[model samples]
Target chain A: MIRYVIRRLLLAIPTLLAMLTMVFVLVRLVPGDAAVSMLGDQASEQALDALRARLGLDQPIHVQYLTFLGDMLRGDFGTSMSSGRSVLSEVWQVLPYTLELTAAAMVIGVLFGLPLGTFAALYRNRWPDYTTRLLSLTGLSFPGFVSGILMLLAFAVWLRWLPVMSSASSDPLTHMRNLALPALNLGLIMTAYITRVTRSSMLNVLGEDFIRTARAKGVRPGPLVMRHALRNALIPIVTVVGLYFGTLIGNSVLTEIVFTRPGLGKLILGALQSRDYTLLQGLMVIFAAFVILVNLLTDLIYAAVDPRVSYAK
Target chain B: MTPVLDIKGLTTEFRVKNGWHAAVRGIDLSVNANETLAVVGESGSGKSVTALSTLRLLPQTGARISRGEVGFGGRDLTKLSEREMSRIRGNDIAMIFQEPMTSLNPTMTVGDQIAEGLLIHRGMSRTEAAKEARRLLDEVRVPDPARRVNDYPHQFSGGMRQRAMIAIALACRPKLLLADEPTTALDVTVQAQVLSLLDDLKRDRGMAIVFITHNLGVVAQIADRVAVMYAGEIVETATCDTLFADPVHPYTEALLKAMPRVDRKAESLEPIPGSVPSISARPAGCVYAPRCNYVQPSCAAHPSLVPVGGNHEARCPVRADKGEAA
Candidate 1:
């Protein structure tokens, strides 16, 4: 298992490099001049040229690309053009917020999705099943931003229970309060995908011979579904959850925007608007690493849940 | 003596496109303590359904025991609430199914699967149950019981896994063990070993067994009494010896004739001419009339199981009279 993990980690290097290279090229390809965007279009040509030279934008594409690769290899993601803070440190500060959002959303998804799916499979074609299916369908159909906005309007504008805009408060309760709306916005979307995956996977496992053995062993309905059926159904559910975890990282952008919260999403957005090549590339690297990490975790969880899956090979 | 399990007029049905169709129709059988009753049948004969119905383990939606009284321990199991029935299942009445490869949970260790019933019904502590599970593994003759107990089902061979399944069913020491073709999926040598193991377990535990299978050779070896089922109905039931010697029903005789033997040429084996009738398309009168060689004009009506001779019953009017006349 250790060897397998090491191999997977080794294989990710090329993937990370490719993503970094792509971000390096693609950010430059966008139709905007980084120096002009930073120094306003009305700035003097000489001043813009000086800013471009300072930002390393005046160099040829290949030279800049090679320099970026060299700096990345040395663990230096240059300072953000707008903030003048180290890109790595800036991303590090906001990474936790995105992680918090994804983790909270995932907790909500599993908490609600597993029970709802098990209930649907058990009742199968009855009202509970139909209701859950309908709820999941509605949840899936609504876009993350639209739901995020609806929630903002409902809780902040009308109810006045929450603030219209979020702030980086130090108080735990206030921080939690600030996090709730955006977390819930992404959480509901995740719940939809998880519920759908869990329901179908559970339906398949419930028909297996082992399920019959469980029943014949006189296992109670509750444990039968949760332990015998759901445990077997977990591989697919975990796959969906891990895939969505990576998605939630990217998806937090809209929720962050709706709530005006500070996070990696906001950081990346600012970098894009101001054409901060260093910060954008750094954020892409983080995103790629997260995707690889989640995939690896998903495979490990598969081995944990299923005994037949041997990583020894 | 009161039988450990008495199933009367048990009719299990499955939902077809039109409506409910009787897969097992008006079946009555009983197993006394320490007796092995083999219900032999071809595929689709509703043998497995009968076992599932007795435990109320049939699928919740598509299938149900439409009519029946499963009498056990002075209680009508069919009338008991699901909550009450669950107490009896795996405690007083346990079951092991065919397809041992898939019957055990892949995610659970062999010991945990066996210990589950002990924990659930016996109220044994986890450690105590673990100990008992190890003992069960030993009882089933699984090698290195201490180590093998922790291995998952996939690690065990087909015979070994079936032994584990038996250990799981026998964990709670149920009075009635419904083994649905327990040996059907094993090798011929493994089949004999499993059969004798079951026979020995039955003797040691004095638990009644309702063994469902298509193999008469297995029945002759392990069954105390045999019921020949054709198209969801018992065509003949007799002592294992009588069943092999003077089978009264045409279906029973045909089934015996089809058995392959070392003494007979492979060409001499006669496959039963036609298949068992589908539940939905069963003939109104006799279920096996179309497939019976001794089928008579009077076979247009269903025949109830009637005594043919001492300790023997056959469900064919023509054959019953012929046996008596002889």
Candidate 2:
């Protein structure tokens, strides 16, 4: 099994390379000139051209790609066209906050979703099942931004319990508290999805003839759910959680803008607005890598949960 | 003598959208000490429903036992609470289902399932139960009982799984064991092995057994008495010798004639003329009238079981007076 995963990871290199090529070409073709934009319109024509030449923008696209690839292999992402700072430094500066938000939201989602789903599945066609089904419907119906605004209004405006927005701060705890609402907004929707998956998977497993056999053998309900039903249900839940975790890395795009947290999402937005081409490319690359890595870890964790699954050739 | 287990006027019905439909209608049966009573019927003939109703294990949401008294050891099991019933199950009256492949948990080791009753009812420690389970496994003639006890259900073949189930049923020395076609899932050779094991276990422990199966051949071998059930009702009951030798009910006679006897048959064996009545769509009058060769005008109304001879009876009015005339 370990050998299989190692091989899969090795094979992912080409897949990642193909994605990198597509993203690189797509971003470059999109109309903004990173080198010219770096000098801004206020600068003279001469100054823009000089900056372009200095940044290797005067070269053909192929030449630029090779140089970028060489530099990337040697661990250099180049300086940001907008901020005139290292692209790598800016990414590292904002990544931790994004990680914190994603982590917090995921924990919240799992905490809320798994039990509700299990109970709903256990008492299917009953009151608890209907209640969860209703709650999930409500959760998924609202868009993230709207949900974020409403949470802000309820907690910050009426209740006046906590701050509605997040700012970059040295103290991560305060930053986390401010970030919680938007994170939970994203989490609520994910919880709805994961719960439905858990309920269906668990319900199917519980209906198997083996489950009745367990009950017949006098195994109690609690252990039967945990040992038999839940373990099997987790296979699908694992896949959903893994996909959600990968998506969380990308959540920084909209989620950060809503919460105004100084994270990768905000970084990407700033890069886009200022037209920092190098920084944008670097951030996209990092996000892709993080998602790929997180998904790999999730796959490994899923294997641990259910031994029957192994990465195929 | 008091019956080891007695089921009287047992009626189970399902609540459909329109109304209640009787699944098992007022069937009466009794098992005496060390006696084997084979309940025989085809699928949906309420054979399994009767077995499950004894423990009140029927799906309770849509299913309700309209009336019944399942008296075992002088206590009516039907009157017991879920908690009390759980305590009784695997303790006093154990049951083994038809599909041993599914009746045992796949993820759990066979020994754990076998020892489960001991742990639940006997309060046996895990270590003690494991040892006892191995011994039971060996007693059931399972190969390499000590080592194989740690193996899961998947490790055992079909025959071995049935043996493991038998080991579990016999764990607490239950007074009565309800086997719902224990050999039905096995190949012919394995079927014979399981049947002999059941016979040996019954003789050795003196435990009364209520064996439910569709195969009359199996009934002839192990059953001391046979009850033929049709459309949720027992239409005939007789000692094994008399049941196979001088069957009286038209349904019983039809079944006897349907039997493919290698020694006695000349032409192709005759099948019962019509299909067994559907449980959901039972006939208004006689359930088997559509299939009976001797359907009299009176058979338009369902006939109640009437005694015909010593320790033998059939649910046919014509058999009591008209003999075997069609």
Candidate 3:
């Protein structure tokens, strides 16, 4: 298993290289020069020339690309043109906020979604099932920003239960209070998807012969559903959760903007506005790395949950 | 001696677009201690339904035992609460299903499945159940059971998986085992092996079996008595030898002729002329009358199961007259 994981990590090298190349090319290809955007439009031509030289824009394109790759290989992501801070350091500063938001959203998704799904499946075609289906449908229909903004209005402005802006407070309670609204905004969407997947998977598993076998063995309803049915249904559930984790990462950008949280999403948006090419490219690399890592984790989890998933090959 | 199980007026129904339809209608069956009663029929003949109804294992949606009294251990199982029924299920009565490939839980170890019954019904400690699970595996003749006990169902061959299922059913050492075509999904050679294993286990344990299958050959091997079912009703019941020697129902006669046998030529194999009637569209008269070879004017009226001779009964008025004349 360890060897398999190592091999998978090794195979990701080409993918990472490709993603980096795309970020490098695409960031440069966008309209506006990084130096021009960093300085005011009224700046003198000589001042612009000096800034371009300092920014390496005056160098040959191939030379600049090689320099960019070399610096990346040596763990230097260049300086943000707007803030003049190292791009890697800036990314590190905001990484935790993004990680915590996504993680919290996932936790909430699993916590509520699994039970709601199981409840729906168990009481299938009944009122409870219908009610949950309707609730999940509503959750699915709303986009992250719409929900995030609405929650901000309802909880922060209307109710005054939460802060309008996410505060970088030292108090743990204040920190969590700041996280609650945005996390839920993304989490509710995750829940809706998870609930649907789990319900269908559970419905399918409940009909299996093994469930009948367990019943014939006098396994009570609780363990029969939890142990027998849920364990068998877990492959699809875990897959959906893992797949949606990537989607949540993407959705977190909109959610962070609405919640006014200082995160990778906010940093990347700032970099994009100022045409901070190096900073934007660095963030893209991290996002691509996250996608690769999540896929690996999903595969590893499949092996853990299902004994039939052999890693020997 | 009192019988182990006596089922009467067992009618199971399934909901369809039009209305509820009887799948297994008013069938009577009994199994004595130390005996095997094979419920033999073609697909959709309700043989499997009878077994499921007895255990109350039918799906809650779309299917129900509309009326029946499953009398086991001096109590009507049909009337028992779900909790009470569960106590009897794997404790006093156990069941193994068809499809060995899908019958056992794939995610769990074979040993865990066997040990589950031991843990729940037998109240054995975890360690004790684990040890006993290995013993049960050995009993079923799973090789290297000490190591293989930890293996999952997918790791085992189809035959081995069925054996593991048997090991689980026998874990609680119940008085009855409802084996619903337990060998159907296996190869012919594996089928023979599982048959012998079940027979040996039945004899040693003195447990009565309700073996549900369509294979007459399997009936001959495992059954002391056989009940022939057609269109959700028992058309005939007799001792295994008697049923094969002198089948009183036309349906039973055709079934025997249809079976492929080593002594019979390949070309001589007869297929029953038409399929069993659909549950919803069944005729009010004798259920098998349309497909039956011995169609008489009297067959328009539903025939009751009546005794023809000693321990032999058939549900055909016309054939019952023939038996009397002979």
Top candidate on TM-score is 3
lDDT of 2 by residue, A152-255 (tens): 89987799876866786668687667877777877887788778888999888887766765566556778779876787778778887888766656554677
Candidate 3: tens digits of C-alpha lDDT, residues A283-312: 888888899999889999999899999887
Question: Which residue ranges in model 1 land beyond 4 Å of their true spot?
Answer: A310-313
TM-score of chain B of 3: 0.98
Off by over 4 Å in 3: A60-63
Native contacts conserved, per model? 0.79, 0.27, 0.85
Q: What is the RMSD, in Å, between candidate 1 and the native fold over all Cα?
A: 1.7
Residue pairs whose backbone atoms clash in candidate 1: none
Q: Kindly report which residue stretches of model 2 are placed more than 4 angstroms away from their true locations once superposed.
A: A54-58, A62-79, A84-86, A168-176, A307-313, B264-267, B321-326
TM-score of each: 0.96, 0.91, 0.98
Against the true structure, candidate 1 reaches a TM-score of 0.96
Q: What is the lDDT, from 0 to 100, of the residue B216 in candidate 1? A: 87
The worst-scoring run of ten residues by lDDT in candidate 3 chain A lies at A32-41
lDDT, candidates in the order shown:
0.89, 0.82, 0.91
Instruction: For candidate 1, give the lDDT of residue A8.
Output: 86
Q: Determine the TM-score of chain B of model 2.
A: 0.96
